[model samples]
Target: MKTKICGLKSLREIEIVNKYTPDYVGFVFAGEKRKIDEEVAQTLRRELSRDIKAVGVFVNEPLERIAKMCEKNIIQLVQLHGDEDRDYINALQSEVEAPIIKVIRVQSVNQIKEALTLPCDYFLYDTYSQHSYGGEGKRFDEMILTEVYKEDLSQVREGLQKPYFIAGGLTAQSISLLDNRLKPFGVDVSSGVEISGQKDEEKVREFLLAASKVS
Candidate 1:
């Protein structure tokens, strides 16, 4: 599986991912403690090479602002982790040059099926949180994902699997544990790869180190 490290705050963190060369790097654009200002996010995104995809994670953000920021930062992907409608997602795609990633709050297979209709370049299966949307550090039942894999996984693999980035409570051990059964397109880490709720460079390096072996 590929790897993506989220909630990046500094150029140092970005450089870590760039040196390791994870498929994608994510930045949060909403919430109080979690949200990153547009100026800093844009500056940091500028430093990323074009080959490495830069993602902006948004939760209930206005479409107009999202389009503007993505354009300003030259971000390649937008990861939506809120209660956004299909039309809104489609409209956003029409307005921006970059692609979209519609995050599904997977409580059941039916929720996974709902993602099939969304207009997105990628799909991220993250832990559903009542409080936080994307980087809550909580994991959903892997068995739920396993069951989905057993059924229409081939379809997912054939279509969107290449760019699919898995999120929610993933660590080195978890990546190693999951490598055998579910070889995903990519893996995304936020809080699980951190120390004391802040981004840990060693944890990030070690997680990517483990992912390189599995992916």
Candidate 2:
């Protein structure tokens, strides 16, 4: 499985990931404590190695703004974590070259079914929170994801498997528990690698090392 480190802030944190060189890193543009503006994200993007892609997390942000960011290549991927509809996504996809990853705060298998209709380059399964959008550091049942995977594949779609990443409260140990029967595209973690409310280099390395062992 691949690895994506989300909610990265500060040049120091960026430097750490640059050294480790994960598949993707995230810059939250939403109204969260970890959120970063366009300028800051741009600067950090410049500092980031070309091999490591940047993902911008947004919640109900304007379509034009997101398109512009992708156009400028500040973020290679857009992770929509809001109530954006198909029309909004279609408009953004039509206008931008960057791939989109729709985040579904899953509470059950029903939510996954609802998300399948949505067009996106990839899907992210995160823990649902009634009080917040995401980054709650909570994890949903992995068994539910296994079922969703089976359900998606049962349709006999063109693809053998639907690409997706599992987020929320993910730790190195938990990543190992991912059923070998279902292979997700990647794993996203934020608070799991944090220490004292910030990204800890040791924890980051440990998480990546642990994830690398997963098939």
Candidate 3:
């Protein structure tokens, strides 16, 4: 399984990720906390390792703005975390070639089923919250996964055709707790690897090590 360390800011954090690179690192372009401006993102992107991909997290951001970021090669992937519909995605696709990751705040199995129909390259399943778009560090009910796949924790199923990443309340131990049968394409972590609102190097390393053991 792949590992994505999200909500990374500052050159110090970038240095940490460079040393122990995750498959992907995220820069928050939306929200108040953890959000970075275009200039700052560009600077950090320049320092980031080429081996690791950078993801730009946004919530209902302007298409031109996101497209521009991709055009500038500041972020390798776009993660939509708001109420953006197909038209918005279709329009954005016309402007940029970067792959889009639609985040589905899982509330019910039906919601996941519906999201599968969207025309995005990947999906990220995060816990639903009333107050925030993401980075809440709360795990959704795993029973939902069992219902969607309709299989035992040790059996694989082809129900979800698209590759996806799981987010929310994920830590090193929590990742180990994931049903080996229900493997996500990747695992996304933010607050889970943080210490007092900052990225912790030891925590990030531990999280990556745990993910490496999966699959």
Residue 46, model 3: Cα distance from true site in angstroms? 0.4
Instruction: Report, for every candidate in turn, its global Cα lDDT versus the true structure.
Output: 0.76, 0.86, 0.88
lDDT by residue for model 3 over 119-205, one digit each (tens)?
888889899999989848999987776577653322223326668899989999989888666768999999988999899999999
- 1 versus 2: better lDDT goes to: 2
Question: Which residue pairs clash in candidate 2?
Answer: none
Q: Which residue pairs clash within candidate 1? A: 1-215
Strongest candidate by lDDT: 3
Q: Model 1, poorest ten-residue lDDT window?
A: 154-163
Give the range where candidate 2 is weakest over 10 consecutive residues by summed lDDT: 152-161
Where model 3 places Cα greater than 4 Å from the true spot, the runs are: 151-159
CA shift at 134, candidate 3, in angstroms? 1.1
What is the C-alpha lDDT profile of model 2 across 1-215, one tens digit per residue? 78999988899999999999889999999866789899999999999999999999999998899989988999989999998878989988898888899898887876777677787888898988899998599878777767766654544342335588889898977888777887789999999999877999999999999999998
RMSD of each predicted structure: 2.6, 1.7, 3.2
**Candidate 2, RMSD to the unseen true structure:** 1.7
Candidate 1 segments whose C-alpha is farther than 4 A from its true place: 153-162
The pairs that clash in candidate 3 are none
| Candidate 2 off by > 4 Å | 152-160
